[model samples]
Target: MKLCFQNDNICVYSLKDWVKLRKEYRIIGEYLGSSQATPTLPIKLLPEEAIFLINKNVAKLIQYPKLLVEPTDDCFKEYNKLQVDLQQAEQKIYKEYRKKELKPYIDKIVIAKQRKLNDSVSTSSVLNEELNRMKVTQENIIWPTLTEPLDCVKGESIEVPKSILMKRTTPTKILVFTDLWEKGYYVTCGKKFGGDFLVYAGDPIAFHAIHIIRCIEDPLKPLHTSELVAFGRLGTSVKKKSVLATKTNETVNYITINWLDL
Candidate 1:
């Protein structure tokens, strides 16, 4: 299978190829459709995703033409414009909320203004300061993405996703991810569930995360009993196993904590 690298993700140009890849290799992404003759299948993938596929030789990278096609001046400019527009819109919303928040003061100010006094000036001053602070935060919030992979980053023979590593994914997390992947488990980020990963025994479409694993470099090390209790409760509530996995010399040990809710 071949994947065209672009927009910090890989694209399988044809729908047929996308279906084949997903059904066979479990490659998942957005099924973006276009109004043109053929629908565009744009798949969003993480840096490790592409790297893992390439490393396993299950898929091929088609990042040719040293100059990337997207993420040009126009793309970034458009994205920034969208961000600004969204910020301004949200600002209007919060401005309404702020008015409601200051309703009592606003009523007092309305009476003061009617009486031709400057008592409301201080309130206006504080409100304006807060609004200005909000505006400042909304400016220059850059979204890190691309329309296609650029030629600047590549290894000796293939494209390397340095951004993923730079994002500081710990070696332990990566090790656990690859280990589960090799064993036919579909692993995804489980930070929301207070675990390193959400492990699915089968395709996510067919099954939910059957286990939530918190990766530990050393299991013998002491951990808070409260943490274990919380993790176990969460897993039990979700009908999944709460596990602590420790790796040693490429071998992982799983210690399952079952909540005996008697």
Candidate 2:
């Protein structure tokens, strides 16, 4: 598809292309007006969005978002077959949805965030030990692989390069995000929260974010006290811890600071 980069977000003006982006790659964005008066098509891409497409080879960067396209069947077969059953205890599976989700690590338990629990299945207290360990509370988890519904994945999965993606963002930022994913914690971009990431200890719908982390690539970079003060205040105001993280070879190191009353 062809999306022009504008105002830090990619813009697509064609209906066919827009549908392909939405239905195939599942790039979610805000839709502008199609009225006769406001005959403009604008879809806002959040920071790293266009690049996410680029790194996945889904979209290219001619400046920001200019990619080569290969006509692939948008069929939902491969993604449909992704759910696996444990041989010892076979159970059902589901793909659920929420806005702006990525499968990220394939081996991890896929959690559908910010959406209502599926009516089809309730959380079963007595599940196989392995299933309980994976933390899939219930079924109905649909993939956003191809369509709007959660748990849906692309029929032809996009091969994203970590090196390509990390280049667009800071090492520390990716470090914290990947680390959280690996550690079984949920994280979302904290653009609105005045931080890099909002750290959720558990399912976002069930629990609120416990921390707001700002990433610093260079560990030696001096942090401004005023900046820390502001972040600490904001985190406390929202009842979340304010954290600063730095990237290293081993893992991301985190430091939390609280605002002092004195």
Evaluated with TM-score, which candidate comes out highest? 1
Clashes of 1: 5
Candidate 1 structure quality by residue, lDDT tens digits, 1-262 = 5566644455655556667656776655554434234434455554455556767887666655543544478767876797777667767877778777776676565566646864445656656755566552343432323333333433333444544433555556667777787788877667778887888877777889899989997767899999999999999998999999888877787899999957
Q: Candidate 2: lDDT of 246? A: 85
Q: What is the C-alpha lDDT of each candidate?
A: 0.66, 0.55
The lowest-lDDT stretch of 10 consecutive residues in candidate 1 is 141-150
Poorest stretch of ten by lDDT in candidate 2: 145-154
Question: Backbone collision count in every prediction?
Answer: 5, 21
TM-scores vs. true structure, each candidate: 0.52, 0.43
Clashes of 2: 21
